[model samples]
Target: MSYVGRFAPSPSGPLHFGSLVAALGSYFQAKSQHGKWLVRMEDLDPPREMPGASDLILATLEAYHLHWDDEVIYQSQRHHYYQDQIEQWIASKEAYYCQCTRRQIKQSGGFYLGTCRDAALTPEQPCSVRFKVPTAIDHFIDQKHGRIAIPKALADEDFIIKRRDGLYAYNLAVVLDDIEQGVTEVVRGADLIEPTGRQINLYHAMKQPEVSYLHLPLALDEHGNKLSKQNHAPALNNEEPIETLLSAMTFLGFDIDAHITSANLDEIIAWGCQNWSLQQLPNSLASTARF
Candidate 1:
């Protein structure tokens, strides 16, 4: 299959340095291989979404010249797709209704133990849908990090695919969309490494082809915390797009020449695509001190 990668971001806030790093990394990873790069807005949760954030994110990507191929996907609009999958899983007995709350799970040894797996709870009753994780996927190859092992407990736990509040879970939407988009590889931050194994199981359950994984180093703040919207990391400066882009590129382990300062956005991005290599990236968390 032709290489296809994506950068999916939630619309809870503007794109920050950390998010920019993820976007740039995915963009170059796809472009370097002459592959298609697509963008998807993880706008599944309305309660947390900031008004106008989605448009702002698109503008930021455009300003940085990280133009994506094909029409951008929004998770909220794809609920029917997610719902259809959930129904199929429920019907096929691959997934079941779960009424266990976070407190219930927390009080009962943290990870969900499938308490409601055979409860026979109906849709009319308040309940979420949880996938009955099949045979555990203990490990998967990470293009950047090599073979990473997952704890068996995590791999075996039945996880939620739909929340009782009626919102489709992140894992559910992401897997379905990636499969729908025919994503050949997933190039995102290392922060998501924990969910990879479960997502792999989801692919197997859906009987869809799995994609390669390349997790980029997470960008950390001076305090050593991962820079993120929740942590109030400042948004990317659109006025100095080149400087910002260069900073992100260097963070991804690119060797930027002083002369490159005179280059335009397209030239800088072309240079990035030409020089992109996962081997050059730092295998640890990247500090945002350069920013």
Candidate 2:
């Protein structure tokens, strides 16, 4: 299969430095291998989305010269497809309706303990759909982190695919989207590593081909917290793309020249692609920075 990678960003806010790092890493990896890189808007959760964030995100990518190959996809527009799959899973016994509340799961040691597996609750009642996890250890090799095995306890817990509020869950939407888009590899930040196993299991359940994964190091703030929109991380400086791009490249462990006279954004990005090295990345989860 041809190499297909993607940068799917939720339109919760504008792109921050951390967002740029992930986008740049994904873009460089796709270009380095002469593969197609696509972008997708994860705008499923309307309550959490900010007005005009989707357009702003695309504009930011263009300003940074992070061009995607194909037309961008939006999750909010694909609800019927997700709902159809949910119906199929319910009919095929691959999933069950879950009515357990968050407090109930928390009381059961934080991880869901299949409390509603045998409930046989009808969809008429308020309920979420959960994939019935098979009892097997889920493991995958990260391109950067080496072999990783999800704990048996976590691998066996039935996870939600749809929420009670008539919304699809992230795990379900993301895996389905990747499969549909023919994504060959997932290159994103390490903050999403925890969900890899669950997503792998989804592939197994659906009998779809699983994609390779490469999680980049997460950028942190002065307070040691991961730089995020929720943390109020400042948006990227669109006026100074070169400086910001260079700083992002440095955070990814690239040895940038101290001074580049008249170097444009395209040239800097090309330099990054030519020098991209997965082995040079920091193995640590967090990097503290003032930028």
Candidate 3:
């Protein structure tokens, strides 16, 4: 089968240094393999989404020469698809509505203890649908981190699939979108490593094919926290696209000489795709580029 990769960025805010690293890493990986690369806007959570953030993100990607194939997909337009999958899961008895509050779970070791797994409650009382997690999940391999096993203590939590407000949860939306889009590989930051296992389990429950996962190291601020919209990280400057791309490439373990700084975006991308290697990436979480 032909390889298909994607960079699905949430439109909560503009692309920051961390988002740039993820985009460039996935872009080069696909380009190097001569595979198709696509982009998707994960704008499902309206409350967290910033106005015009999606358009600004696309413009930034274009400015950095990270063009995608086919029409970009928006999650907001695909609500029906997620609903269909949820209905199927419900029919199969693989999911159940839970009325457990945050305080209840917090008092029970921070993981949902299946408090409402068998509760016969109507949807009128504002309940979230949760997946019935299995007792044990087998180990799955990470391209960068190697074979990894998620302990039952962490994997046994009954996780939510649909929020109380009826919005599709991230795990459900992402898994369904990947299956629909034919994504063969997922490349993103290490912050999502644990979620990958959960998604893998969901894929198995849904009888969908498993996709390879590669989680790149996260970019951290001076305070040692990951750069993210929640942390108030500054957005990328569209005026200096090349500078941002080059900085991102360097963060991904690419060795670009000072002379290469004069190269255009296309030329830099060409070199990057040709020279991209997973082994060059640092395993340490502290790996970052100096701004």
Candidate 4:
């Protein structure tokens, strides 16, 4: 398959430094290989989404010179797509209804213990649908982090596909859209490494081709906390686009020489496409103290 990648961001807030780092990492990886880079707005949860956040995200990407190949995808508009696949899974017994809450799962040793697996209960208004994780995926190959082992016991637990509020779950939505977009690789932050296994199982259960993974270092604040919207990460200031882009490039372990660093936006990005290497960076997560 021809190389293809994406930078899907939730429209919960404006783009931040961490989001920029992830976007640059994915963009560089795809462009370096002459692949198509797409953008998607994961805006399913209306309660968490901010008004005008999606447009802001697109505008921010444009301002940063991270151009995408095709029209942007919004998750809210694809509810039918997610719902159709979920219904098919339920009919085929690949997934089932789940009524367990977070507190109940936490009481059951952190990970879900499949309490409602055999309930055969009718789907309710406030219930979630859990995917029946097949035992097919034992491990996933991360391009930068190497092989990540998954225990068979963990796969036996049912993971949610739709939430109690009727919103689609990230794992399910992501895998389906990735398949739909033909995403060949997923270059993201190390914070999402833990969900890779479950998503791998989604690929197998959904019978979609698995995409390659390349998790970049998590961008951290001075306090060592991962910078994120929920963590109150400040939005990226488009006023200093060049400085922000250069800093993000350097954070990704690129050797931005003085020539490239001082070049115009388009030139600097062109240089990045020619020289970016996902394999060159250390696999471990690092902090961006200056952020």
Best by lDDT: 1
* Tens-digit lDDT string for candidate 2 (164-257): 9988999999999999999999999989988899998889888998899999989998878999999999999777888888888888988887
Scored against the true structure, residue 250 in model 2 reaches a CA lDDT of 84
RMSD in order of candidates: 1.0, 1.3, 1.3, 1.6
Clashing residue pairs in all predictions, respectively, total 0, 0, 0, 0
Q: In terms of lDDT, which candidate is stronger, 1 or 4? A: 1
Q: So what's the TM-score on candidate 1?
A: 0.98
| lDDT by residue for model 4 (120-150), tens | 9786546899988767466778897788766
* lDDT, model 3, position 104: 83
Best by TM-score: 1
* Pairs in steric clash, model 2: none
Could you give me the TM-score of model 4 versus the true structure?
0.95
lDDT of 4 at 274: 90
lDDT of 1 at 186: 95
| Candidate 4 least-lDDT 10 residues | 282-291
Show where candidate 2 strays beyond 4 Å.
258-262
- The Cα error of candidate 1 at residue 88, in Å, is 0.7
Ranking by TM-score: 1, 2, 3, 4
| lDDT digits (tens) for residues 9-42 of candidate 3 | 9999999999999998899889889999999999
**Colliding residue pairs in candidate 1:** none
Model 3 compared with the native: what TM-score?
0.96
